[model samples]
Target: MAASTKNVSVGTVETRGIEPVPDSERHGHAGQMFWTWFAANISILGLPLGATLVAFRGLNIWQAALVAIVGSFGSFALVGALSLAGKKGGAPALTLSRAVFGQRGNAGPTLVTWLSRVGWETITTTTAAYALLALLGVAFDVRQNSFLTVLCLLVFIACTLLISGLGHATIMWINKWATVLFGVLNLIVMGFLVATVDWSKVLEAPAGPSSGVIAGIGFIAAGTGIGWANAGADYARYLPRTIPGRRLVTASAFGAGIPLVLLISLGSLLTAGDPSLATSSDPVSAINAMLPSWMAIPYLIAAFGGLLMSNHLSTYSAGLTMITLGLRVPRAWAVVIDIVLMFLGGIYFMLIADDFYGPFSTFLTLLAVPISAWIGVIAVDMLRGRDYDPDALMDTSRTSRYWYTGGFRLPAVLAWVAAIVSGLLFTTAGTGADDVWFSGPLADTWPGVNGLGWAVSIGVGAAVYAVFGGRGPITTPASSPALEESVR
Candidate 1:
């Protein structure tokens, strides 16, 4: 029989690795997804995203709100849809990818997904550390120093490791309770911030061009959900198969969407009054400056808590992805390795780097291409009714069913590569026109200029894969009683 949730209580390390959860062990309602995604997105990062809409994209309050709604909700709905794969296969997203791409072929997407997770976690850790530093400064008049910066990074990483190392049960539990506690705190802070908004300026701001709205939506979608598309299954894998898939999708969309819409709109409103929030190198301090002195402590605390919630989930998924990459270690140990890397990354971001958003924007743009391509492939695979073979997923040898053509699925790999190349042709990343990091040949095209490269990547990946990839007969898992018995 499969293990029970009772055996995996809070604070207990989840012993399961990348293998599919046996059906008997699967237990959870789709409603839990609401809290899971809600907690993941409750971070204050949405503010800057919204601010960028107004300050950079040149959208007014109403247009920015529309962009936030469509961007945040629509993208996460796709995440919810892809999560159905996890419910069916009961494995991590990348683990299930072994079925779509052969074992060796899966390595590329796995590596890219892992890098995206680590990159996001590092950003979360750095932001959370900044929140702590700001909190200390507000409460104790303490000043930032090299020692304190490193210490704060360690402290934030330690907190992340604690929950993520505990794995699924703890993450689910924390997601629910932490979301409630921090959600209320954030609302209170938002209430204060809202009071200070210059209504006159906000109301009078002219609407930006319709093109800005399109680009703003693309930017928000890429930043908010594209980064998370690969990890959807990591959390959903434990849910029972019988749960309504649409309910899971709705829960995830609304859970993430509601807060994001509010935060992003609020960001736009705030930026309409003071554009500095969009341009500030230190967003934490910039937002703090807007609040009254006493509210600073709770506001920063809420920020820290929110970032922690997001970091733990990212770290948890990164750990699973690491193991999927053939790391011969326990999941918890994998989390430790992830934390160490995040700590190093946080140190570099805080102490070494002079610019934050520039590198972060570049990271987001460059990685979104491959990740979206993976999403495109996986989404199409799901449509074809692909199912995972438990035994084959773990077998890396030539004898495995998924070891096609020397462990590569030509159509899927080719489509992914081709889509990435095509998408990059219209992609560009940098802080400003003078500091351009990379720009593709077709970057002058409307889609590239409008920041729709990630969108184009997904469409190209899906179109190419759909045309070339599904010709092979769908490989269903064997119905052997012995195989079923072994898994149980």
Candidate 2:
């Protein structure tokens, strides 16, 4: 058993603020935490629904499955590493960042956390709007236009407020119900398609192999893992200290990684027949093609409910990030703000933001580099046995080890910058001599470079910091209100 609360206090001075809850109250048995994390991590569906439409383009079922597997690993490995590291260190996200960035320097990672929530919210809202319209087409005939999109945006805004206001407990409650509905709907769609589509056609390989199979896998991994990579600590924090780190890793990996590969691969198979599925990118359309028109009612209801469940995640996560950053205001207020902003972002993307998805895809790719850096640095810190207290991450007190030379570690920052630039280069440029000579070498060799950016960013940061900045031994803050926190 872990130490009692009386012994765990920061000092003998026990002024009663919301002093961190004790280990017993905070860290319950692993089973409860496992289910909670599982519920949160299951939201990976939203990503593939919007993202895989672009990635699996023109690929057969086998090819798409292979690609999704690769992608699922990206998320799996990163989260597995983080969860294990955190368990050993006994701290969570912001506190972990303090080890590398210094107590004062933790703001950098926090900013990234905020941006991710905003970006995710925008993407979720925009994509959900698109699907909502498609489902509506099954019942009331309406063309895709600014007016129709506005209506969808209104609905998203309203639901976002509800979910965010409810906080983590309510969101998890909704997720349990939503998961049931999603599983049923997906089964029906996949079952119908399996029965309807000529298996022979889906089994056939593409006339030519994908030029960027590895890249496709990396893309899938990044998308699948993105949620957990940033927020692993959010759920890990709730885990019983008695649970071994290895067990947590296994639970998180199976709960998140395995299912995503299956779901995304199914989506790829779902779209294998229709070359123009992107233009007609509605799940309802996907089912309609599989079954009779009337059958779509049940499927649509299930899908719409699932979409709401997924939307609850973006809103909830966004509120958590905002509150952790210094919104001492009511949780309800934070959610209201997020919903309003998400609504505006939705309208902006549909009405003003042309190429909403193209850039969004690139943005997601680019983010992998920096977020990967944060993960790498923390992993290195833990492995090396440096200070690892989560509560002390931002403490400016003299005993704080996180305040390194000048309160900022140059090595980690440099490594992060390099990773970000590398991701950008690949996202913007294509690989090849022609791309190099005509458009430039960076452009030519970049686009084809699948998971290279993630590998490079994560690897380079870890290597550089390990070799050069390894000398610093510092105590991380146990808890800092200013440091960013992730949602599980």
The model with the greatest lDDT is: 1
lDDT of 2 by residue, 290-325 (tens): 666666666656555555655666565556556545
lDDT of 1 by residue, 1-488 (tens): 12223345778889888888888888889888899999999999999999999999999999999999999999999989888888878889999998888989999999999999999998988899999999888788899999999999999989998999999999999999999999999999999999989999999999899999999999999999899999899999988877878888999999999999999999999999999998888899999999999899999999999999999999999999999999988889999999999999999999899988888889999999999888888888877767678878888889999999999988998889888998899999987889999999999999998999988889999999999996643646464432222212
Which segments of candidate 1 are over 4 A away from where they belong?
1-7, 477-488
Looking at candidate 2, what is the lDDT of residue 346?
76
Residue 233 lDDT in candidate 1: 91
TM-scores, in order shown?
Answer: 0.96, 0.79
TM value for model 1: 0.96
Stretches of model 2 off by over 4 angstroms after superposition: 1-21, 28-59, 84-92, 134-148, 207-211, 279-291, 323-332, 394-401, 422-425, 429-443, 446-448, 471-488
Candidate with the greatest TM-score versus the true structure: 1
